[model samples]
Target: MGFFEKYLTLWVALCILVGVTLGYFFPDGFQFLGQIQIAQINLPVAVLVWLMIIPMLIKIDLKALSGVSKFARGMGVTLFINWAVKPFSMALLAWFFIGYLFRPYLPQDQIESYIAGLIILAAAPCTAMVFVWSNLMDGEPHFTLSQVALNDVIMIFTFAPLVGLLLGLSSITVPWDTLFLSVIIYIVIPLVIANSWRSLVLKQKDGDEKLTDLINKITPYSLSALLLTLVLLFGFQGIQIVTKPIIILLLSIPILIQVIFNSG
Candidate 1:
């Protein structure tokens, strides 16, 4: 790994600290940035997401999509974990710990919201960041791309209903419109742009060379954009993180469990 990739965790930690500090000092600026949203998706973060996701997607060879079947076993495992296990298991964990065990310790009104957030977080698998993980693990690119594509399709259909079911079971209100909008904004649009750009790149005279050069040029920027996105995300949540450190820690139990469980 290169220096930036090798020390990503340190960089991210520093960015989080910087983001929180800036956010705490400039609440109005951050709030204004946060308010520039459409359909509940923040505009600046959307741009950064595009910058981060598009370059990664550019590395994908859609022609290799046909070879995805060769890695059926790996894809199947990913599907089972991401769809069948992660969300439901997270819901159960949220209910057991947040609903029952941590009830008295957490804020009364926000308890349901907290659990709802956890359910939402786990409802869909990681999309863009999976590329980074696949690289880190020396995983097959075709398998990673295909698995992500399949998960995206499944998520489009299942994410809302599954979330609604789990949240209803937990008696939490479902924000249907916002959820759908998020899928469109985050998943649908980025996929289209990435593939479109890929097609354009491949149409050039020296297609492969052009694509490689383009990817090399923009790849570094992708990580930089990711760091910026993290800053904005942390900035938006800065006050909450500061004020409700204990609640944040408690609410994170299900997420920690889910990660450990899935990674195993």
Candidate 2:
């Protein structure tokens, strides 16, 4: 297993804590970085986002895309889990807990924003990172890629509808522009770049074990960039992030359940 795969949650926790610390201590620096925006996207995090995605692009073999139909079952399972099952289940959990169970514990003003964030997260399936999860589970990579690609494609169609449906319940302002930009930058561009670069390089060279070695060497660079980006995201939104406790608690249950179930 890759280093990140072996201790993924731990690394994420570390990154979150580091980001919160940085944001807390150097609040001005975080604000300065946040202000550097292009196309209305934060520039520093955008660069870090590039780092996060570029490595995944390098690993995608174009041949996998061509071979998608060969692994229909896996694709179906992925689609079912991501769309049919996960989203509804999360909605149920959020309703039961946020709207009822812990409603008394949560602040009334932030309840809508908390629910909105959860809905946003639910609508978006894991991209660039799910491959790692799939591989660790001894999944078929071709099928996994095909599955992820299908989800990405479907996301373009479903994300807005689902988010609108769920977030509408709480009456939150849906940021359509931010959502679309996120899909373009984080999903579409990275997918295109990774596939094209890997395909072109392999077509010219042998794409042999040596090339694989080269890729493995550089893979961590992109991961480092991703981790850095997450750090900055949490850092910028530090103290304000803790305002909603119930939604955080609710999110943990489903995620925790998924991790254990997937692992088994």
Candidate 3:
């Protein structure tokens, strides 16, 4: 692993701190950046997501996508975990930690809201970041792409109903625009651009060598964009983090448990 990858945890910690501090001191700037959104998706973060995933996507050979059928078992397991396990498990963790164990410390009125937030978070599987993670693990690129695409499709049908079921609500408002716009921005556009660029690069005389060199050159930018994204994310929540440290910490316990459990 390279230095950046080797110390990614440390770098992430530092970025969180930097983001929080900057946000607290210069709230206006971060708020301005935050407001640049459409369908509740932040444009700056969307751009960074594009930078983060495009290099990994470029490495994917769309022609090899037909071979993804060989991993049907793995895909089935992923879907099972994502749809059948994650949301309910997260709701259970939220009930334990936020709704029960830490009840005395939390505002009774907001307990339901907190649990709902965790359920919503867990119900939606990640999309763009899957590529970055798969790249870091040196995983199968085609499988990762296919898996993310499948998850997105399943999420479209299942997210609102699942969340409504877990939250005990009769009907939940699903942001249809956000869902479709996110797919277009994160998957469709990036895939098209990356494959087009890959094809163009492969037409050169020293095609393979040039492509390899180009990917190497752009990989750092991808990682850098990831770090920047972390900064922006933390920055957006800096005020709540600073003012309600204990509440934030307590809320994080269920989320942390949910992530570890689902990922495991």
Candidate 4:
């Protein structure tokens, strides 16, 4: 592993502390950033996400997509876990932990909302971060890209209904704009930019060597962007995190459990 990848946990922890501290000290600045959003999607974070994923995306070979069929069984398992198991399991966890176990600790008014939020979070699988994870694990880039793309597509159709079912709502207002825009900004745009850049570089002299050099040059920036993103995220929730540490801890337990459960 590279140096940054090797100590990524430390970097993430430091970033979170810095973000919270900065947010607490300079609330106005972070608030200004927080308000720079469209359809509730933060633009600056989107840009950071682009930076984090584009280098990884650049390494993908579009021709490899044709061979994705070879991973059918693996893909099937991923799809089943994502669509079938994850959301429902999270809903159950939320109910058991939030609605029942931790009910006395949480505000009565926000219990349902908390449950709903967890369900929504579980329903929408990670997209851009998958690249970072795949990179860290030395995962197959082609499979990672294809799986993420497929999940994005499935999320569009299933997200609202799954949330509604879990939340006991007959209908839910899906954030169509946020969903579509996120896909465009995070996936479609990055993929296009990466592949176009890849094609251009490969047409040059000593193409493969040049491409490796370019990716190596930019890899640090990708990881840096990830750290910045973490800072921004923690900054956004700094006050809340500080004031409601217990609540945050309680909420996080299920999320942590869910991640471990799903991974296992």
Q: Please report, in order, the local distance difference test score of every candidate based on alpha carbons.
A: 0.81, 0.69, 0.92, 0.93
The C-alpha stretches of model 3 lying farther than 4 A from their native spots are: none
Model 3: per-residue Cα lDDT over 225-257, one tens digit each: 999999999898888889899999999988888
How big is the positional error of residue 259 in model 3, measured in Å on the Cα after superposition?
1.9
What lDDT tens digits, residue by residue, belong to model 4 across residues 111-138?
Answer: 9999999999999999999998887676
Better of 2 and 4 by TM-score: 4
Pairs of colliding residues, candidate 3: none
Summing lDDT over every window of 10 consecutive residues in candidate 3, give the lowest-scoring window. Answer: 254-263
* Model 1 per-residue lDDT at 111: 85
User: By summed lDDT, which 10 consecutive residues of candidate 1 come out lowest?
Assistant: 170-179
In what order do the candidates fall by lDDT, top score first?
Answer: 4, 3, 1, 2
* Best model per lDDT: 4
Which 10 consecutive positions of candidate 4 have the poorest summed lDDT? Answer: 132-141
Provide the TM-score for each candidate, comma-separated.
0.86, 0.77, 0.98, 0.98
Give the CA lDDT, 0 to 100, for residue 259 in model 3.
Answer: 79
